[model samples]
Target: MRQPMIDTYEEAIEAVRACGILPLAPLIPDHPSLSGITLPERWHSDTELDPWRWRVRFPGDGIAAYGKFMKKKAILVASDLVPSVRSLLGSSRSIAQRYGDGLISKAAKEVYAIIEEEQGIETRALRAAAGMKAKESKKEFDQALAELQSGFDIVISGVRAPRNEAGEVNGWNSTCFETVEHWMEGAGIPLAPMSADEARSRLQARLGEHSSPQAMAYFAKVFGF
Candidate 1:
C-alpha cells in the first residue's frame, strides 16, 4: 500500500500524532512508518524530513515521545499516548526487581546502572562506562541497551556530536540515553491512568481503524499487543 505523506518535521510530528505509533522504519508492512511516507532520498540528509536524523533527535519537541518501543525498533508515540505505551510495554518493577524476575539480563542491568549514574549519556560513552567497549562486546552491549529501552527503563533523550579538542563537532552524532523519568522531566508528558490491558485495547482499536486485518495481525504478533 502507498504510505502517507510527510515532507517536513512539522508534518512528521502531525503524522505521529495522528497515527499514535509510528515506526522510524518499516516493520509491519501496513503499519504507519516515517520511512514509508518520506522521500527515500531524504533519509540520511540531516534535513527536517530525515528519518535517520529523527531517530537521533526526538528533541523533546513535545509532539511525540521517541523510544525503542516496538520490538526493540525505534518508534514515535503520540505525546498523549506516552503513558499508555509505557503501561503496555514498560515494567513498573525497578531494574533490580526485574533482574530478579529473569526478565532483565545481567548485561542489561549493567547498562541501566550506567544510565542511572549518568543521565543522558551517549551510546558510546555508555558502553565504555559499562565495560562493553570492545568490539566483541558490541552485540551484548547493544542488546542491553535495547533491553532497557524496550522496558522503558531508559529513553533516548537526544543526541551529541563528537567534539574536537577545539570543542567543535567532529563526527557523527551519538544518541543520548536517560531514564524515562529523567527524560520526562519538564517535558509535560500526558497524564492518563491507563492499564496495560486498556492500552492494548486502545491500540488494537486504533490499528483496526486504519490498518488491514493482515497488518493488524502482524502488529499484534510483532508488538505482542
Candidate 2:
C-alpha cells in the first residue's frame, strides 16, 4: 500500500493506521526505512493535533509519545496496538528488571517519586520538584526520563500552557507527565490485549514489511524488536 501524506494529526493518525507505527521526526526524519511519508515532522505540528487535543480526542488512540523504535523522545503507534507494544516490550518486566538491576538511577527515582505523588505535573514543575533544574544534572535527568518512558512507566499526558510567575499565560504550553495508568485514565485510552510474544512478533512483522532488510536488522539490534 502507498503510504499517505501526513501534514496534520488526522493525516498522522491515518499514517499510523497505515504504517502501524512511526518514529518522531527528530529521531529519524523521513522514518528512513518506512514507506511513503511514514512519519510526521511533529505530532504538535498544528493546532488541530496538539497533545492536549490528542488526549481528549483520541485518548487511548494509539500514539506512543514515549516512542519504542528508538531511544528518541517520541514515536507514534496505532491505538489498538499500544497494549500489545507494551506487552511486547515486557514493560512490566522491564520495570521490575530496572529496579532489580538498579537501572533506575537516583535522579530517575526522584523524578518517579514526584510523578507518583502528584499523579500528573508539567515538565517545569516536574523538573523543579525532582530537583533536576541544575544545568549540570540535565544529562542525567533526561536519561532517567527516557528510561522511564521507554520502559512504559511514565508518559506525556498533555500540554499545560506556560504561565508567568504571576500565574498568567506567558509562553507556549509545557508537556505534562503522568504515570501510564494515570494518562490512560485521563485520555480514556486503554491497552489492546495480546500476549507478550504475540505483541513483539506483530510489531516485528510490521517493521520488516515497512523497512529494508538492512534497516530491519538495524531495528532489531537497536530496539530489540
Candidate 3:
C-alpha cells in the first residue's frame, strides 16, 4: 500500500473512515533527517504532544475513534509525519477473523448467554471470530513491533467499541475484527451453526476457561441451543 498523506487531522480521519481502516499517528522525537518537515514546533518540545500519536477512525457507520501513541519511531508505517513510522503499522485481518470465530464459538458453548442477554447471533459470532483471528493478527502485530529499529515507546490503548442508539454498548466499531471476518467469510469459513458441545470445547481450549454464565445466556438467545 502507498503511504497516505494528510494536511490535517480531519483529512486523515475522513480518509481512514472511507477506507474502513483506523489512522494512527504517534509522535516521537525529531530526527536529524526530519529538520525540514513542516510540523508544529511544539510537537518536539511538548511532553504531552506525541507527534507520533495519530487519530484512528473506523469505517463508515462506526461510532468512536481510537487514539494511539508510541514513544519510538514506527518502522512498518511509512510516513513523513514521523521517521520510523513504518514499524507501527499493524493489521487486524487475522485478529478480527479470530474474534468472529470466538463469538460464534462462545455462543455455541452456552446458548443461554445469548438468550438471557438478548444478544444477536451476529454479535456473538463476530466476537468469537475476532479472538481466533487474533492468533494470526498477533503474528503480524509482532512483526510490526519488531520492525521498529529505533524510537521511543509503544502502547495499544484498546479495541474501539461503539455505542447503540441509546448509548448502550454496541458492537466493535473498529476494523480489527470486521476486516478479518470479511476475509474469513469471503474465504468460505462458516461462522454459524456451531453446536454447544463443539463451542464449549473450542472455547475452553482457546480461552483456558469455561464460558461465562452471561455469555451462555446470550448464546442461547442467539443460537437457540
TM per model? 0.87, 0.72, 0.21
Residues 111-205, candidate 1: write the lDDT tens digits.
Answer: 88888899889988888888888999999998888887888778777888989899999888888888877666547774445777887887787
If ranked by lDDT, best first, what sequence of candidates would result? 1, 2, 3
Candidate 2 structure lDDT: 0.60
Query: All candidates' lDDT scores?
Result: 0.77, 0.60, 0.31
- Superposing all C-alpha atoms, what RMSD in Å does each candidate have to the true structure? 2.4, 4.5, 19.1
In model 1, where is the ten-residue run with the lowest total lDDT? 184-193
TM-score of 2: 0.72
Report the candidate with higher TM-score, 2 versus 3.
2
Q: Compare the candidates by lDDT and give the number of the best one.
A: 1
Whole-model alpha-carbon lDDT for candidate 3 = 0.31
True-vs-predicted CA distance for residue 183, candidate 3, Å: 12
User: How large an RMSD does model 3 have?
Assistant: 19.1
Model 2 ranges off by over 4 Å = 26-69, 93-97, 186-194, 205-219, 222-225
Steric clash pairs (candidate 1):
none
By TM-score: ranked, best first = 1, 2, 3
Tens-digit per-residue lDDT, 140-224, candidate 3: 4333322211211222222345667898878744322222123223334343444445544443332222334453443244233
